[model samples]
Target: MATIQSQHKWRFFRSGGFDQVALDSAADLQHLSELDPKLWTVLNCPTTGLEFDCRTLALLDLDGDGQIRVPEILAAVRWSCERVLDAEIMFKAPGLPLSAIDDQDAEGANLKAAALRVLEITGKTEADPLQVTDLADMTLLFSPHHFNGDGVVMAELTSDTELAQLITEIIQTQGGQLDRSGGLGIHGDSLNAFYQQAAAVVDWHAAADPADPLFCPLGDKTVEAVAAFEAVKAKVDDFFVRCQLAAFDNRAAEALNPAVAVYDVLSNKAISSSDKDVAALPLAAIAAGQSLPLGEGINPAWASAMSQFKLLVVDPLVGSKSKSKAGHLTADQWQQICDQLEPWRSWQAAKPDTTLHQLELERLQAIVAGDGKERLEALIAQDLAASTFADNVDAVERLVRYQRDLVTLLRNFVSLSDFYQRKHKAIFQIGTLYLDQRSCELVLKVSDMARHATMAPFSGCYLVYCTCERQGETPLQIVAALTAGDVDELMVPGRNGVFYDSQGRDWRAMVTKVVAQPVSIGQAFWSPYKRVAAFIETQLQKFAASRDKDIEAKTTTGVTAAATPASTPAATAAVAGFDIAKFAGIFAALGLAVGAIGTALAAMIAGLFSLVWWQIPLVMAAVLLLISGPSMLMAFLTLRRRNLGPLLDANGWAVNTRAKINVPFGAALTGLARLPAGAKRSVADPFAEKKRPWGSLLILLLVAVAAAVFWWFKLN
Candidate 1:
């Protein structure tokens, strides 16, 4: 309940049954913060599903929370106003004039420069105003080879071949980030990580010098030797264990060796030296205290592995000592070979986890020794320097969008002027729905029909929820408020209509649900009569159907009796004859009932005609009021209380005021069918259905007879 300050002199206009602060001038926008939040038409609105520009809404949603609140709106207004020389430019559309920026402010000066740069890149002159579309492609403003202030350093930005190669390698190995210019590149953080990892790889590789025989027993061939030895290490160990078991018990040799049944199974298949089944056998034959044969006698499955092991291991360890040793490796010699490569195994286990391991050790040392890291850091720093300019350029685009959309949002959000004035549609008024011989302009996009219907009834307006469909587009649900038309044709579900969206795209709309409420006082006045007439018609139809069934049954019974041959005339008379007394009694009862009804009608007519002419009309009016008065009163009250708050609140808007849609405003929202003014018409029709006058003549005859009977009784 904070009052407006006297110095600001705030202007107010009443709409939606409440006072709304009118943002009439630039000063109003500047002093918007001073306006109390309670007076604002809307406290908050969702970012999506609105007819307004989503981009502008996103910019105004400073916290990226998918909603724009009062505070965010004020912040956006203040920021845009401070950057521009004239705050009035915000009310303009299509573009922002570059010269209008307040160059005295540092941020505004940067924006001006960025705006000029944008125009220059788009092949426009300085006199031209920069538009949001002109800055659509940011690559035009920032080249991949130049510093774009994104802190990412692309290889193309460097001139030195070595520095460029270093950047390219880092991107390929460490995975680069996306730059503002759309190229993948690194920043200062990635550059430092790359060097730190490279240093670890260099130090890890330094521990395994080739000249040191302990780690590299075979020098450059040690890596290949390790691979060869590992392949048959387990199989060779199994063979030696089998030999030791044979020495323990000579009878155990037969059981330790491959059974004869295994050889029989291998014999059936086309076995190779690499056959998996054959490889499962021992590397060599088992015997008491036997050395593993390095040549010729090894199993075919393990022959290749044994040859590599002997060439790399046996030749190096045995070292040309007399050809009499016979190319066989003792168990102790195998142990020596495994022990020789232990240091290399430990070094491999300690290797650093880095992508830099793919690079040569010498290249890594060279990069660490030189100033390549420093140069890369300098390039990254250069890119970061232009970050302020890039940020302002982005800000310039936001301001341009704000210029065209901000005030429009203010009008809709703060005061609903756009809706009340009827000059333009409000942000929530999605489209017009043409259905049931009427056009509805107050339609909202419904996300969930059932959920919306639950709260929509509280709005006190007749709503038609339709599922709108178009080819290749998802079916959209929308609720249209029918404020001006009758509900007879609109109350039914599955009724089809055409919906034209804000973009004028036509969708075939089908009514999925209807919230039945009074649309107008005229409709309400006749509702009672319509209901009574409908009830009478339904009862008449049922009565006629039952009478028709009875007549058919009677005719069938008579035909059967006539077709049957009676034994005598007496039997026939007994079967079909009518009694005179019964006929007299039936006629008398019918006469009495008709006379009683006639008497009641005559009495009512006599009573009606006893009054004076004025009294007669007054009596008739009182009767009419007794029937239709309650209906019209209820409708009037409901229509007067038709608030737009609940409908929008259901769609995720915090409407603060009682935004009423009264009778006059409701009538404007929904348009009824009518002929245009000054149009010619033909009352006579050649093809029209012929009307019979007999029904009217009958009604007149009945009224005249009742009148005469009443007069005759009065004269007596």
Candidate 2:
């Protein structure tokens, strides 16, 4: 019997027979909580829009399994409220330094330390006050950097100079030893060998006697003469040796003939020139029964005569042969001897040329100086130092960002307690009910009921039942918003009623049990609208069916009566005979009927076209309202009168309070199933036939064309 007073600025309405209040503002909710702590039930409920930080939610969870239950929520609310005053002081002046948090408690000590670190890494002095801007700046530190890794403040060498230094150091350290061919640097031994070879050629030239034409030829003409004689002598010796070997070994003949051919050419030239005596020695020796010493025992004078040749040719050949079998050369040794010949010959030709000698000396001197080595070492050192400094900077930044995030999280969780304490409804509710012969479970929670609720007669508020048939037996369950009347009717423990759900599924529901409690009944002034809708629906359906049956009967009777005359043989014959006058009269009547219909349609169309475009839309809108106004009005009125009394009474409850499940509150009671976040699932029936939309598209195209043609004509 308690009615809400208008002066209180809070409105109260009867819902499910209980005095219910709608708290619109934060202050209104706070006042309601002060009136009764039980009203704080909404604080423990999981809400959709609050968007609590995941870490804060986890901290409140206590068990750490990511679910915040009622007990956890209540504990969080109490803890936060107790510490709220301390938090408020800090929040009121966000610019306060870490020293502002002066509590002796462990949590306070941790916060103070965290605040100090945040200020330090953000490049703020300890004396500098923290601001909202500082917190925002700290969040930016978590942004992604060039490096690919997790955590705030990654190693970012953004400075071009620093990055270039890093690249140089890497190249000097790992790629420092590479040669021109991209192979590893030459060994110390190879460097020494190169120097020794160059020195040897120079020394040989320096030691040469200028007076001895054989050892050192000074003029171009003299050099040519000496080279020709040496070449002819060498060829003759090689040929004579091959001929001697051919006498003992048949395979030697193959090499002997080629050498003989070269020797004959040289011998003919020698015989006709002044060098015949020198060239004929090896040939005459071979003809005499003596086999020339091809190994170490060769005449010493002959060897000495070839001493100038030794460094240029003989020494390399001898050295290679020494590495092989006695009097025989291995393939590798032969190849080495041949490979040394070209470079040796080149050196010999350039021995007297001072220009090349000076250039070679300068290059050798530069290599031994070691200036490049020192520069490379300095670069490596710089690179190492830069890397260490960068790593240290990143570490400090990460610590600072971590501290900032923690402070922000604490601020959010602490403030949320007041927010929830002022709230008045649960995110969801659960109940047990019976439908037909089956027990049903209900999870009632909705986001917005005013927008989603149905406006169709009893659809606004009714006991909805859903039945699932299994194994030839159909089981029914009730999924409805209960009213006081429904509870009262069911309180007897065996009340039965028929119910229909949104899907039009029928259920014969019966009350199996009822729990006694303080119940609310919904009784509003608009309750009569539901009754009116039900009456209208029933009467309309019955009238339409009766009228359709009557029309069908009349049509059938007329057809039967007309066929009776045709059925008789005499009448059929008369009807079949051609009657010009009668046919003409029938045609005239048909033409007149069609003409009248055409004329009336043309007049209506012309009247519509005569109206201005703006007025035409208004007229059409008015006509539409005339057709659908009654149904829409009925639905709207019924929706406004939606009550929970009949639903609750049907389930047997002694209602004492008005617990109004209004548009908004009713939504939170019944939750509809929705797709989970990021969920994707596709189902396809294998037996389904593929469909072509072309036929429907073609029909739509034709309709559009016809409309366009009509509009064009109308405009003209």
Candidate 3:
């Protein structure tokens, strides 16, 4: 029988010492021969669908880059995946036993090998995602790390070393160590039940009991806790005082992520279960077949605080915890919940070097019985029996030893995962900080290029206006100069734009909203809205100065005096603060107004040339309003929805914003009337252009009235 010859190729496979060794060109293609000869024949055989061999390697090396990147080798790899790899490297492997080749066992082996293979490919050398247990841990320890927004913890407090230390101490002091991995139960034993027991044990110290004197010594600890808490507060005060900018360094979040992730992973059941499958299985299948819900089960309020949170809802209509929808909290509610959850997440984010993938190894081992090494050895011995020399002890030993090498692999897998989780957090944080700081810095640098924000140029300014928007449904806003352009863009809803540079990042706000036409600072004082009215007042004051001081004073006094009547509750109630009765009342009044307007419009149309268009609601509304008297109920109702901001501000509170409303056109006027003194101009009138079609209403009313009049006229 002729021995099948190996071919030359260029490839980098890791040596035992963890060094890259070039093989294909320098040596021979033994990677294939390492499997069974029959399987190899079937793969490369003419009759089989799988094709290509050494020539395939040549095709990969044709490029000047001189290395076979992932894309270049895909064709051969894809063919290999279909049947070749399984035939040779797997089922026909020289050392594998016939019994182990049975469908069930082979299935398990295939699954495990797939898991291991995934790690070999696609994973980055610098920081492997699969290697890291808690990517945040590695991220925090690495350099160029910066603080991003925050985690579940009070970032402002946690960023302070003193507060962090105090928190660490407080948790340690309060939280008795839980033996998370200590006990294992067989059969139907519930882990959640065990956790509950553990919880009880931990809280036992906090419970008040006459027989239990744990509370006797609580006095001393309270004082100490107070002192520690105070000390932490002091440090926070100093950090705030020392901060030169709006927020802490961006990398600060990166540093915290590791700790946060640790707690999160440890507390998270889904992530841990996903990690369990990693140790026993091969990388490829483990990764491809399953995805981890890491930190997914975090407390909703706390999870909401976490930026990574994704809301999942089951049948929200039905009552099921897991089936709940994402709950959107108000800004205040969001802040309140986030404040509570941040600390818990911060504590969880810090554990382990291995990632969810690596942790799965332990989990798989625990489930299948025995550790990773035991599983690998059993697999190797079982497969070696499939060889033609299945009865030979020597071959069996060699195969067993070969498969045992998996221990080294398993160890490295754990370490690498550990590194990634740690570093990922730090890197993410740093990236965040860099973006925020750089955005502001870039804008400052570009001011000269920006043409000195006059009203015209300012109106076009879409960037630098993205603030915490009242609603995500709306676009980012800006105080634009109407003089810059037509100001049409400012009036439309969602007329917002984001600015991006050559690189897509830190998109600055570029929203535009025209509040007023240009005016002097003096004229604004006599105007209703300050910024616009003040500028007018400023210019008019200069002109009026030569004319008469008394007239100027009178104008200013008239403006000031006009404001007093508006301060009353009646005016406040005139806004959209209307109740059920009021809402209906306003609609009724509006209905009558439109009826009158429609009548007048129809009359004008009739008078125009004997051809009438009675569809006009405006003229009908005017006519109806004139015929029907006032609706005191609607007037009373409109007063209830008076703007919340003005209500709060008038009681010695500064609204402290140039906020606008998202009320519809007609509602915009009502909204504007309700605006607090601190409310920004460009405040929309509730009833701006949002007029619904009156044709339908006109038809309905006209049809009823015309029929009645016609019947009466016919009878006469």
Candidate 4:
């Protein structure tokens, strides 16, 4: 890959500890494709979650894969530069001028024509340079009723009432697609699907002609007859099966019929004919070779259903034919009714499954038989004819955006000079987080804290992940880099702050997590001493609490003893008495402890006095180094190695450069608080504590002890 080269001469600048090619002119961007991909700061970046214009990013992301890669950027740059006559005009201006468009090439000419058409439609024919906002006003270019080459025809596209109502019915039944004009309409696929379902429904209804005895069974009344048949079919079949079983074995009849105990249970409570247990009994008494008595001997629970069945089904097939008695249906007659309705059952089962069935059959037939489908097809074709115009308008939009945003993107992607020079916030920097008495500008939007934290530790910079929220909006997480301030107050997880986005929208932010690293060398220098002080304070608090508990227990014991009736003066005196021997022993131990500490102090003071003043300073310096040296050195190494790559990579960018944020650069990213210039200061305070002489007396005593030690050393 190194052997491969471009003829273009590239100029480079040093930043982030690496060389980045300069994209300062149109020629540089025109030749960007020939440049080495290895030198680009970012190979690709997500089209979302950035401070840059997302609309422009979407235009650059040709594949629509949510990432804008080097090839896509190169293609966009090449296309935009070619369409312009003087590519240098892109950097100098914010909009694309009509005269600047190169009309020599066919593509460029088409784009210019489209731009003119857009201007004509918008009444901006005199607009020298077409702005991005002009193209964004879609209402001016296409109305809800106009065809904009999206292949969708809205109901208002036709003035014919029948056609419009047909389109509305198609949309209501089929759930139409939304068109570019913001109206719900149908494209070819949806329109074809709707009519096809309509045709199927018509064919299904036609197959059930009332004149066909095979399907309708009872001319003009088949549906009602079939419904009645279904209602009583199961009970009638059960009754016949029980009769067949009784003929097979006589004893089965007595067992299959309702037992006397069932009536005994019903006798204990008020019962209705429609009661569930009563309906649950056999439809009629089971008997061998018995015709089902439809009228008088029938189970009261099933009487209503049997009447409808007799009128609709049994009467039509058997009573009308005079083949059976009026009151009963034999087993053979029931079989004949089931056999005659089978064709209709099969026909009904084949009905189409679609929401189009909601339309009346006649309406469906009229729609299928009319020219609505052909008209819709023609309308879609007409809409599709404007596709080229629509695409050209988009090209105009892209041209305008590229003229405005191409150079900025090149700076952020190819070089990152904007970030390094501190002239602009990088695209990945979402907003500034004001926290811990400091304003951190290098804040990035975070989607998932757990996922970000996994790779963020490698950045070697102190980061705080906060959940920011506003009322009536969703909560989002952001990670802010704390580079300049002391970390003493920043490591608290529940700390609150305010974040201002690039648009100046304020959100309440609360720190939910802290990824600790060296914020600054000064903070590291005091960390060890602070830890020691904290440990001492914690121990003192524990000791005080224990002592208080012990004293309280003793006081309670004394009060109890005083209230006791059996407590004598002798007992009280024994408890209160202190042994003189024990007192004397404790005093001796205290004296020995004091003597040992004083001896150690005297030795240190005499040794210091014996040394020369210069040597004493050196000794003190060495002691300080022993305490704070390792911490500062470690902090320095970490601060130097802080790279912005991992932070961006965790957010879905393929950052190709190290993008180091060394100590000085890091400090610029985070701004510590300071008073305004010329601010006044005063020493007097009404709430200040009273003046004290103990500090001065302690200093005087220390000087006197040093003088006495020097005198004694001279005498020796």
TM-score ranking, high to low: 4, 1, 2, 3
| Cα shift from native, residue 252, model 1 (Å) | 20
**lDDT at 571, model 1:** 92
Q: Cα lDDT for residue 600, model 4?
A: 95
Error of 4 at 21 (Å): 3.1
- lDDT scores for all predictions? 0.86, 0.42, 0.30, 0.87
Misplaced by over 4 Å in model 3 are: 1-550, 553-609, 613-716
Off by over 4 Å in 2: 1-51, 69-97, 103-113, 120-533, 563-716
Can you write out model 1's per-residue Cα lDDT over 486-578, one digit (the tens) per residue? 787446998899999999999999998888888888998999999999899999999999999999999998899888889999998898777
lDDT of 4 by residue, 1-716 (tens): 34347888899989888898878887887788888888889988888888888899988988889998888888888888888888898788687778888989788888889899887877776556798988886656777677789898998898989989998998898898978777788888888889889989998888777787787779888889999999988988999999999999999999989889999999999988899998998888899988888798888999999999888888878895443565878898888888999998888889899999888888998998899899889989999997877888889999998998889998988889888988888888899999878899899998756778898889998999999998887998999988887787556989899999888999999999988899888888898899899899999999999999999999998888777754678887887788999999999999999999999998988898899988999988888788999999999999889999999988988899788998888889989888889999787999999889999999999999889988998799
- Point to the candidate with the largest lDDT: 4
Judge candidate 3 against the unseen true structure and give its global Cα lDDT, from 0 to 1: 0.30
Candidate 1 residue pairs that clash: none
TM-score of each: 0.76, 0.27, 0.15, 0.89
Q: Candidate 4 clash total?
A: 0
**C-alpha lDDT (0 to 100) for residue 349 of candidate 3:** 45
Q: Which consecutive 10 residues in model 2 have the weakest lDDT in total?
A: 146-155
